[model samples]
Target: MKWSMRIVMTLTISLVIAVCLSLLPKMDSSIGINSPYHWPSNRIGQVTDNNLPDLLVQVPLQMRIRKVELSSTRMSLDLSLPKNADSTSVYRDLYTIAQTMLMKTKNVNQVWVRVIDYSGVSDNASTQLVLAMVAERESGKDMDKSASELSLIQLEQELQNRFRITYTSKWQQRYPL
Candidate 1:
């Protein structure tokens, strides 16, 4: 009887551990909330934060960046993704990356992101624009601003307030946003 009780307790503990282990990767705490869509980093350009000023860049787990530009009020990035990235997920990835950039540098009022086919870059004017978007910050003129760390929920709310991106595919984007 004593051995059977110990066996049952051990089995219960083992089951609990198994269930917890299985859920760890799916937990929201591992990455930011809704943060699963950045592109793969092994494609074309390996990006670093050398050129960006007043901002620090963190490429989300799988994404690679080709070029980045920062101006007085805007941040622009040319991201490289898998050649076969899914169409539906492409926009989501771009949007999430854009939001991440904005969250990282709360001072910037705009972020422009695009994916261009690296193989076609010899013809700079004609590179295919797979997917592109621009997200502009929308803060109430009346609200007080501070340098506190931005929460993921706040980032989502900020994206919900951006102006519509009407003309994004002009790939050689010159910025003065």
Candidate 2:
């Protein structure tokens, strides 16, 4: 009789563990509603009044936005600078300026940017560096590819037109290699 009881206890414990494990995923799904993890939602492309406000013009699947910063200065050849010149300050200034301008752009949902490196100075009394960020487009099944392409192209053109200052020598760490 004692042996039978022990066997029954083991089976009961195993069943309990199995039941708990099965419930874990359902609990996780419930808790994930407010989580930041992007999940595959059945309504990924569903249009609704709430999502309408968030829509920034049907982003494409592969749209890219690049951030560019320029730094330029003039120095005499006699002024010998160190081989590793710290140009962090120059890059920071350019990044701030470019970010501000990009925030005002339309159709682009997000913009990311960073400084690459100092391009270098030329005989024309100018030392310049560049910073940039490439943002990918968030695409959905309901999104229009053509519209997304146009938006990306327009954003690129706008940046070029507005901040097309020539750089003597530019160095960048992150580029679309």
Error of 1 at 120 (Å): 5.6
Pairs clashing in candidate 1?
39-62
Q: Candidate 2, residues 1-177: lDDT per residue as tens digits?
A: 999999999999999999999999999988776443422232233222333223223322121223322222110011122235444333333333333323322233333444333235445346333434433233111222222243444544434443433323344332221
Model 2 Cα shift for residue 35 (angstroms):
2.0
Worst 10 residues of 2 by lDDT: 70-79
Please give, for residues 8-119, the per-residue lDDT of candidate 1 as tens digits: 9999999999999999877856564323232223222212344242122444324467787877777787866555554334444555655455444445677787776665
Task: Please report how far candidate 1 places residue 1 from its true position, in Å.
Answer: 85
Please state the error at residue 91 of candidate 1 in Å.
Answer: 2.4
Q: Which regions of candidate 1 fall more than 4 Å away from where they truly are?
A: 1-57, 61-63, 120-126, 139-163, 166-177
Which runs of model 2 end up more than 4 angstroms from their true locations? 36-112, 115-128, 132-148, 151-153, 160-177
lDDT of 1 at 53: 27
